[model samples]
Target: MPWDKDASQCAQFDRVFLVLGNHEFYGISREDGLKAANALEVEPQLLGKLSVLNQSRVDINRRVTIIGCTLWSYIPKEYQLWVRMKVADLSRINDWTVENHNTEHLQDVQWLQQEIHNISLEEDRRDLIIVTHHAPSATKTVDPKHKSNPWGSAFCSDLLESQVKSWRGSKIIHHWIFGHTHWNTKFRQHGMIISSNQLGYDSRGSRAPRFFNYWFPQSGQDFVITKTAKV
Candidate 1:
């Protein structure tokens, strides 16, 4: 697959951190998602296949502590995927088979809630990075040109406002990076830098991968850099 080639392009970096988006689980059975989550329960080492294995408030490096999950989305009703559960739909359609993608959205928020609270208790450490596939709240979405729509909720989280209001103001996370929106974003809010540098699939053709570079433990002198490679 193209990603195999794409993955190699990232070798220059010291480490790669990731969280699956809803797209990663698309066409995957809910049972498979559960199984994948369970496999980590039995053997956490395998999580390297999914990411750096630092999802659970683990110290990712001397410079950064990371916690992340593929967050769920409460899309606006107008933006939701068309629901279809007709007679063969269950077998043929992937949307219905997503198995409560929206419901899991809140669970992801709670995870951040608890993890951030736990990190707040830490003595002294590197800054934090909050990773999710979906924008936690509308502010994270941040597209004014994006037309106002009641149904566009599919892009960002619904419960994020309720949970993250306190966390954002705390200035605990230095950077928040996510995917799924397919925007090349870099915005600052509440003393945190949120980025969504999507290596997106172009409607006309395949787009290249983009990189965001930063120092391992400390960033200064324009530490963050972006590079793109065409395969």
Candidate 2:
């Protein structure tokens, strides 16, 4: 188990950035979730070497910049259920404690907004990408079956509608990738290509050899990523 801390396992990828998903915050209650999250906090130096991030940005290979964060989901109503539960099994099994929620604390969202603002001030945009475990825009979070319903949308719609557009300066977000709603969706919105991905998790462990395949998502799909042009 101690070897799990090793970052070399991901040597296959040139860049690796990890973040805490709502799953990390799923527990009996908000207090428990908070404790759970705290327990997940790896040593900062160790996390840096592993390329894990939270409300942070990084320049990879001097070519592209990626920002990562996780936002709380909208309150539970039957409509928001489909969008926030993540997956049917997870919905049924995991207690939904994070929904009554935290985007209002101004901690996560504010940091992301400031990051964008800072990036805008710099002359070099160089392919900026946004990656969060939760959806930010309504257009990206809506349920296809109930597109007209507000409950089927994201928690922080205003942040997407105004806050991002009115930042210090203008910059185009070419791609936005998220996880919470474990669906493989791709569409172009505003001027960016937005998409979401998630690896469905019914259970996590290796007690047996019958969980799921790595290349294929048996629980659903591991998160999806939007591939953009080279900067």
Candidate 3:
């Protein structure tokens, strides 16, 4: 699917990284789904320009390193059963049980923590930018209307409270960009810039506002990242 004309457009860049999301596993076995997703990195049509970041890191330059993963959320215990039965992921992704989901989430969290710890020990540390498919924090990510809804737990994790809070004064990590809630937002939290810029659903009635056009101009120019912070 990554070789599709629209997706292959990413080849225009010297390097492109993709973080597989939940939907990427839909309609396939977990193992097969991962194989398919990884296939994108080697897609010949893209001239080997794409890198699928699965609990991995890539140094973009001497100053920046991006760590990326699906980073699946930790569904609240009360909502776990509801999510298992009601969410389309369980019904569609073959061999993917709620237990599997929980296991992957834990693994991803551990991998991220270890990666950060390794970086912290390095004599020359690069500015870390985490890119996750799932929202790292639930705060201001869930729709205000669904803030009290148990289902909101499916969209984001408590990484902000559980992990990021511990790095409040750390200077190694600078930004965390994520998506899943489909809410476009940018805010500073725990000494880092957290942002989500998503196209979301195409329908006019979609709850997530459609601001992709503004963020990504139709003029074919690359969007600029003007938001900066002193690390």
Best by TM-score: 3
Top lDDT model: 3
Candidate 3 has a TM-score of 0.83
lDDT of model number 3:
0.72
- Give the poorly placed runs of model 1, Cα more than 4 Å off: 1-12, 33-55, 76-99, 140-142, 158-162, 203-231
Q: How would you encode candidate 3's per-residue C-alpha lDDT over 1-231 as one tens digit per residue?
A: 333555656756787778888877777787887787776667678787787889988887778788899988777678987787656777888887777877888898888888877776662467898889989888886556556766666678888877766742345778888877756678888768888766555334434234533322221222234443334
Tell me the TM-score of each prediction against the true structure.
0.66, 0.63, 0.83
Residue 41, candidate 1: Cα error in Å is: 12
Candidate 1 lDDT tens digits, 1-231: 123344553455655654655444445664565455445434433334345232455665666677787776664344344422212223542544334655676677767777777776763445887777777666645445442544345556644356565763345677777765544567777667777666444333223222212101111222224743111
TM-score of candidate 2 versus the correct structure, residues matched by position: 0.63
Per-residue lDDT, model 3, residue 166, is 71
- Give the range of the ten consecutive residues with the poorest summed lDDT in model 1: 211-220
lDDT of each candidate versus the true structure:
0.53, 0.55, 0.72
